[model samples]
Target: MPALASDVTVITITRRRPEILLRRCVPATGRQTRPVDHLIVVDDCPGTAERLSAAEGVVWHHASRTPDDMSGPGRSSRLRNWAARQVSTPWIAYLDDDNEWQPRHIETLIEAATAAGADAVHSERNVFHADGRPWLEPIWPWSADDAEGRSLYREMVRLGVAEPGRNVIHDRVDPLDIADGIRMVDTNEWLLRRDVLLELPFTETLTDVHEQGLLGEDDLLLADLVNAGVRISSSRTASVDYYLGGYSNNRLRHQDPDFAWR
Candidate 1:
């Protein structure tokens, strides 16, 4: 049976950062206008799980820790896959431990997906500094000085899709124009169907970061969706605050001189 589009479960994975996860992401879930039906917090650290267990409306689960899952960009996909199995809601959304959604985040994305008859839909995100503001620095994060941020910002600027202060990074991925290279489909900006996620899980993402030293699980997932002809669209509204300089950002590419995601 095709699942109804109304019910939604949010999957958030954290390894050790309880402070931000509790302070930001959990509250963001509770404050959602659509009122999340389920909020799954998968953590590998037992100590972190203990700290987050008391979080209201959050079901904390302890996942088995793998050496590969300890640090890197691709680990998120692995953690998300772990949490996806536990979700019963027909609609599924993603949020990172270090990121936050506006109160209308769920409401906005749901409306867009339903209206477009899309299997998955995404929203724009404002790339903010650690102090909770958009990039206003002369030494911009999106400048050529930063390898990762520059790569992301360059594409978004050419596309003219994002407008956060001076620099723009997160926008929306158009499957039709996906071959053109769009950096807008960050993990937290998307809402997708549970059936679609299960049918095409991001299982092999760890290799992109852990082995190859290239950070690209989200891109691969988007490719999978496009290849499968999943109806994907974008809300074109900036509903997420993707904060930089978080714990994971520092350690995304933990090893190798070749590649680093942050």
Candidate 2:
């Protein structure tokens, strides 16, 4: 049986991107096949939420941040964690302000999770340039095709070439195992059970700090979930269109040699 729309809540954390939220995220979310029970927007920018028109059951929250608040890495994680607490649904789906989901995204993930008995589920995404041209190459780690190293690790464990106790892939293969994986999953592509998320909330700490920029609160949260014996079901069908624009993180990546755009 398919999960009811009332069973899931879609949460979006945005800061000063009202145009993108109104033009892209809002419409796409409204089109979900399994309509969400509620749409929660955690707006960090003051006065931005008021510009958005009201809809029945759409909840808007403005994050209270003091002038002394740390503005770097864990900001999004904190806002998302706060929003998760406001969700009364069984499942929580996340969407960034700049990205748009296909109508079936929530429907697909919910069905997949129900069938697999997974605590979390994620789907592959199609990447596009800001002008809307498709970026043909698979986004590494997010797309299963690029998981060659993970596949190799799993094979090594099965052949006893690598000890199961020492391998990360072994954790995902068995629900009871709680070892961290060698790779990180994309935060935006996942849908998680609300209770599971509450149990292992996103850590409000930075995982990467460089002179160029800071990163990885999302990676830390995913790693924590994987380490807590959460079984994730990933799908290859691309249901989200990730737009690579002049966002702050993308701006930093454009200048960083290690993450230069191909």
Give the Cα error of residue 227 in candidate 2, in Å: 1.1
Question: Which lDDT value does model 1 have at 246?
Answer: 41
RMSD after CA superposition, every candidate: 4.6, 8.6
Give lDDT tens digits, candidate 2, residues 1-262: 1223578887787767687777888888889898785454544566576775454445677677765454444666677788788767889888887788899988888888888898988876666667677644323222223466467555545543344332111112324343542343456678899999899887775543421333355556677776786878865457878777532335344453323211
What is the C-alpha lDDT profile of model 1 across 1-262, one tens digit per residue?
1232338888777766788888888888888889785455555688787876665545766777554344445456666876777667888888888889999998999889989999899988777777777775433353324666666554555667545455345576654665675543777888999999999987454543434333456667877887788888888788988898643344443454433342
lDDT of 2 at 237: 51
Q: For this target, which candidate reaches the highest TM-score against the unseen true structure? A: 1
Give candidate 2 misplaced runs (Cα > 4 Å): 1-5, 53-57, 70-72, 137-182, 207-215, 246-249, 253-262
Task: For each of the candidates, give the backbone clash count.
Answer: 1, 0
